[model samples]
Target: MAPPAGPGATAAPDAAMRALSSFRRRRLAMRGAAPPAWLISLATVTIALVAWIAATQAGLVKPLFLPRPGSVIGAFSNALDGRIDGAPLLDHVLASLMRVVAAFVLAALVGIPVGLATGLNPTLRAALDPFIEFYRPLPPLAYLPLVIIWFGIGETSKILLIFLACFAPVALAARAGVSAASVDQVNAARALGASRVQVVRHVVLPAALPDILVGLRIGMGVGWTTLVAAEMVAASTGIGQMVLNASNFLRTDIVVMGILLIGALAGAFEFGMRRLERRLTPWKGKV
Candidate 1:
């Protein structure tokens, strides 16, 4: 063939270079089109920190009441360095986490089965619905005195309080989930010679999983809240205890640290639950 009419005898090299350039341009455009979510989050945090620092520097707020971020960071570091009594920050965090997990597990263990039975069976629902309705509205802390009397002012009492807080929500959610199972699915399973147990396992349980997970999330949050209250009663070690101690000393830094720590921990747990829910319910549509 007579050489191409361009500078290069052939257009192949030019086409390849153009394709590569286009790809690079596209990638650059994509990168520049939107800021990463993490960057936005970091920017937000930076803005908050700057605002706080400015407020403190301007003396708009008292350091005693609202210490500078550096002070909080220093206190946190000091807590890690064994400046505080009792235990390190990690220990306190671990202790609180342990109690919350144990209580939540106990709540799930007791509540799920009760919910299934009550929800699936008319007679059981009739019998237990009244009690559930009665107690669900009542605050778990309100029964702390009775729980302590029954279980003593020890781990058992605290765990029981958390369990009570978590249990009602789980049961109610489970019951709602079970009841919400599709009638068509149940009938199809029945027609296929599946037993009631099979129907529940393959149809009801799978369908109800989303609701159950939602319940678990809500229940865990309640359990965390209850843990703090329970720990306040007679805890020797916990974030709750830390807050109580800080309050006694009027160490607002420590108080703020304790509150922040609880929020951070709760947020961590919530994140974990969300991941778990996503993993388990891959087939379910997003909420």
Candidate 2:
């Protein structure tokens, strides 16, 4: 039989076992660690671009269905020189951007307050909820004719269509965000002699900010999607208009170019909103 170990002898072994366990854990953690998100995104984009080039070169897909990247670039150059439908790319971009930005700003200005009022006052919520909910699920195209009849096929109708598209999501997000603040926090604010307005301004708004930002992001996406439909209202100049014209003429390369431009713009907006969210709601996931 082995001799009994002393207390000091066991302590050394225990220390070694702990060191071995820690080393194993660290090795496992290192092996399981994911690569940086940006690297993964880059790799994904690179692979997609390579696949697209290879597919086009291999004639697996016709140029009509998927134009070569060089053809799309040529279309882009033509757009810049006002050769594609005789309007410069800047003109189309600005028209669409102005309409989208205007509608989004208006929606945010109006929706946030209405959402707050409905969230705080049951009477207001009861009165408005049915109307909002009734129309919320309806697609913008369903009411396009009505909008044109009421407002005419002009800028007003176009902006209004996009506004209506953006409003519901922002309002609902703000309403839902109102519940994020704890009862304890509200009570604490009230107990400290904060007025109703003060409590809301300080506590409620901050708590709901994350959700509001999220809503804005969602609303912006909806606005972009609605842009094409909105610009369809007798529009002569806009990215959507350009794409529509290209489609009509079977200018698939121009169509592809316009699509890529719109996607790039929307992606930029998404990236901006994400940065803003991180800046404003640093404590978002921490809690």
Candidate 3:
């Protein structure tokens, strides 16, 4: 067999080594080219700062109305230095975050079961559909007065407002997700002697997770929007309170800072939710 084909007869080792080297080089190149998210974020901030500076210098807007980027940064620094009342900016952020968490948890706890029941039972859905439709259309802020009256002008009222804001979206999304589940999958589970609970646990919940997460995301956004309105009622400390107070003083720098902080917080919260969704539902396609 020609001495069992000497090393010269086969270039597989050399080819394999070249292929491995090529893969490593490609990987290193990709790593070098991958843009950092922080860098993109910094670029966005720099662009906004440049725009603000240009506008201020060109006399396109009044300082009292727009303020310079430097002023906003100064306000942020002052806030950090304990120049403001009712705790620092970070405290306000944490307070708002805590309220959001409380409200979201409350909404999820109640909404999921109601949604499941409504989705599984046509009669129940028919009975509750009218009420849900009516409430879902009504803005949460519009009901703030009534909520305050019922729950008092305390944390309860604020939390309830957020809960109401979150609840509608979550319940609606859950119902939709459950209804959209594949009938074939359900039937197959049944054919395999799976009980109703088993089918729901093994098939329905998993399939509906993506939709449920979507609803959660929407609900959280709505809740954040409602936060300002809620704080406008009886809040002593929060970013919303900061914005409202700044408006009274005509401190445009603080107002702008508050607004930017709100947006940043909302974006951060949404990003976290997206990450959580990815982790929980790895089988789902990337957003």
For model 2 the local lDDT of residue 178 reads 92
Q: By summed lDDT, which 10 consecutive residues of candidate 1 come out lowest?
A: 2-11
Kindly give the number of clashing pairs for every candidate: 0, 0, 0
**Which ranges in model 3 have alpha carbons more than 4 Å from their true place?**
1-46
The CA lDDT at 138 in model 3 is 91
User: Candidate 2, which segments miss by more than 4 Å at Cα?
Assistant: 1-28, 31-33
Best by TM-score: 2
- Please write out the lDDT profile of model 3 over residues 1-287, one tens digit for every residue: 35587786578888888999999999999999989989998999999889989999899999998998889999898877658655788888888998888999899888877887788889999998898889898987789899988999999999998999999899988888896678999999999999999999888888888888899999899988888888997677898888888898898898898888989888998999999999989988753
Clashes of 2: 0
lDDT of 1: 0.86
lDDT of each: 0.86, 0.94, 0.88
For residues 1-287, could you state the per-residue lDDT of candidate 1 as single tens digits?
Answer: 88558766467888999999999999999989989998999999899989999999899999888888888888899888668745888888888888899999998898888888888999999999998899888887788889888889888888888888899999988898897688998999999999989998998888888888889999999987876788877787888888888888888888888888888888898999999998999977754
- Over all chains combined, what TM-score does candidate 2 have? 0.90
Specify the highest-lDDT model's number.
2
The order of the candidates by lDDT, greatest first, is: 2, 3, 1
lDDT of 2 by residue, 129-246 (tens): 9999999999999999999999999899999999999999999999988999889999999999999999999999999999999999999999999998998869989999999888
